[model samples]
Target: MRTRILLAVAAAATLTIAGCGKTPITPADSSAAIAGLGSEHVKVGMAYDIGGRGDKSFNDMAAAGLDRAKEELEIEATEATPEGGDDEGRLGALNKLIDSGHNPVIAVGFQYVNALTKVASEHPETTFAIIDDDSIKADNVVSLVFAEEQGSYLVGAAAALKSRSGVVGYIGGVEIPLLQKFEAGFAAGAKRVNPDVKVRTQYLSAPPDFSGFGDPDKAKKIATGMLADGADVIYAAAGGSGAGALQAVAAEKGATFIGVDSDQYQSADAQLQPVILTSMLKRVDNAVFQEIQAFIKGDRAGGTRRFDLKTDGVGYSTSNQALIKPLTPKLEQLRQQLYDGRIVAPTKP
Candidate 1:
């Protein structure tokens, strides 16, 4: 089923690029025009990370943006997950998109750097946008990264304030610089609020193992341990793994969990719903949608594009209206301070 979808997407992308500059095509026209070129109407393609679709984190958020482009911008877009493995699958998907003639092929995670760097160089005419990691530099690629530290800092402060015990916990999917930025910022924020606060940090896996991000068993075990050690609030930066952490929090009363990447409060299970105190919002959907819009408008660029707290790219969610109401005033003040240069959150690990 997935392979068939990828082939269809590749064919559509080929047709779109082959038909460019001919006529403004609508959905009805797409079939005929693409058929003439022996292609389809797949104009935009997004290659998802290892976490893939339905993780309720990074990839899901990017998919939302692609969906927006399809609706608002009248572009035909589809998402592809790497088939073989993380590295091989990412490269294969990227190559397929470019070979099919997609203009701005979107890569959804930082894990695509090596694949994108090679693919972007080979196909200079193709534009690429990567999220999270930005080690790659190419004239045809745009790097979209967020200030997780700033938002994590705010959530950390909130956790500190709400904790009956001075102990808080941070559970990461994998120990990478990106995750480290969350750890550092959360620690800094907690310290700023309460110097004596004890912040316990752990990762589902060490390194060379990206599989941990989606591992629920490991996350649950880690969270359970932290809860037993007196952690009242646990901030989970572990993609799908965080779901397990939320599960642990729900099982134990008087414990709270902080979400990441999106407004998880809205999507979490009803049993664990109230346990989610706040979520660190990384506006990947907004960024992806904007980038796709730019491509449609012919404004795609290269180099790194930073989305921070100042730009409203990163922050905490107020999805639960009643809960967020009280924090609004303080959040607004902190937002202004971040914008006015009064506060500088760490960008890199």
Candidate 2:
């Protein structure tokens, strides 16, 4: 879908009226005001990550953001999914969006960082926004990164509290700094709850392969091993690999699992639903929408934009009301402490 709207970036100048006062207008403020202006029909484009759409995770959350933008901003938007799992394929799709005249293109995942950086630099007139990755340094590009550790910490505490075996586990897609943030926070949260709790960590691959994220069978195997080792709650930071953990939890007796990115309560089958404790909510949708809105309003802030728990950009899911009701108040307290600077979460692994 495409919508066309006229948008102009006003130049800075001094306006003088006869027998009146003179007013000075700065270029930055004028550009911001112009970007803020939205018409009945605006065109936007979105590029999905490797997982594509309907993974019920990161890509899905990003799609939701695009959908919301369509409804609220009356934007005519279309999304392009990569044909194959290569950076070239991803860049090709993004190029198609730009060549087709889609302004303000938004890349859904960190995997698009290099592609976006290259494209944004090539097309300085086009605006771009990226989530989860920050490889791009162009002024026309906006990078949205999150503090996954803060949300993971709270969920880790919940996992430790609910674990009967006193052994918790974390499974990650890769060992990169981003995934490491999730692992470290979860481990810290679990340890904070129970000093004696054993937190086991595992990654699908050591060097990090994008394909490993969607391997459910691999996730199931890792999760089953953790369960066999007396792990009661396993937190999955693996993208598609998380599905395997859910499957293992469903098959295993008396084992629980925590999901990442989005709430997996409804994503799982009826039997597995009960076993899903909660998800570490990374509010990617909010971040995406806010950035797009800013771009439309000419208020684009070019640089790395951090989304933390304090900003309500990242958090633990409360969608599973029955499972999370008892823990909400305490979690809120911790969230407040983090926002008030009373609590500090470690960023490094």
Candidate 3:
């Protein structure tokens, strides 16, 4: 009882300070509601990857959805964070959340694949959602997967078209298959537009070393070196670390960058916005909100829910509106061509 009160209070405090996400609510009303939620609280537990909430990228987008659920679906939510990428620690955290009575829990990244599936099997009545990976199967598990490559392809095309040096670059946070899709699509899109264009792909770190997602300095160093190599435009698929790449672009004139996972042009530091040409929008918030609505409507089918370009789950951003206006038609044509199956994005570099 004491713990619940403390947690509820903390959450209320956070709500008061937070910008009210995609679904905002009045603090006084929400606080009273949170305190009284109890067994009736449409509770959702979220387990965050690596850098957790402050990434201002992937995790922040997920937080937006969860925040929306709090106000719109009247869900009481709690989040768990890992020290790094420790699978065991992640499992422990997830199980504890389940034991504490939060149902319809979500694991924010593929690192939780094995642990999430195992736990979901033990609690069949409770709905479970795993982001980024969909191979897991169980009556209670729901896969929240996205077509990231489709969005990457658009940004890749933009980078190629905007590059005066004819060489653009791509940087992946981790060398995992998920980030691989970003690298592959970026390279392919660039090649599609300018067959002679050079797309340089670099992975900051390998699996089990997810620090790549959080390390801005390392990304900055790599972006610097890549820029020195004559790459005028760079696309970064690294999480928070991608911000570092933007910093590098900021330092150089006429150099632009591509962002990932969120509308980072809007999310980034003001000075960095000019350098961020556009971002690949992976709508994690929309996915989270949709699932919560499904649960509210009693529609858990225990299957994969794909948020692809076809469903507006992903796309390119125009936060730098004036900069991209001239290229919108071309980009739109490519997007439609890809969506209509006229163009296919390759997933391997």
Give me the candidate number with maximum lDDT: 3
- Candidate 2 lDDT over 230-303, as tens digits, reads 99899999988899988998788888789988777867777678888888878677676666666666665567
Model 3 residue 155 distance off true place after TM-score fit, in angstroms: 0.4
Off by over 4 Å in 1: 1-42, 321-324, 347-349
Q: How many residue pairs in model 1 have overlapping backbones?
A: 1
The reply for model 2, stretches above 4 Å from the true place, is 1-36
TM-score for candidate 3: 0.87
- Per-residue lDDT for 199-263 in model 3, tens only? 88888899677788878899999999999999999998888898889999999899999888888
Candidates 1 and 2: which is better by TM-score?
2
lDDT of 3 at 39: 45
Report every candidate's CA lDDT.
0.74, 0.76, 0.79
Query: Which residue pairs clash in candidate 2?
Result: 35-296, 35-297, 35-298, 36-297, 36-298
For each candidate in turn, give its C-alpha RMSD to the true structure in angstroms. 9.5, 10.3, 7.8
Deviation from native of the Cα of residue 269 in model 3, angstroms: 1.4
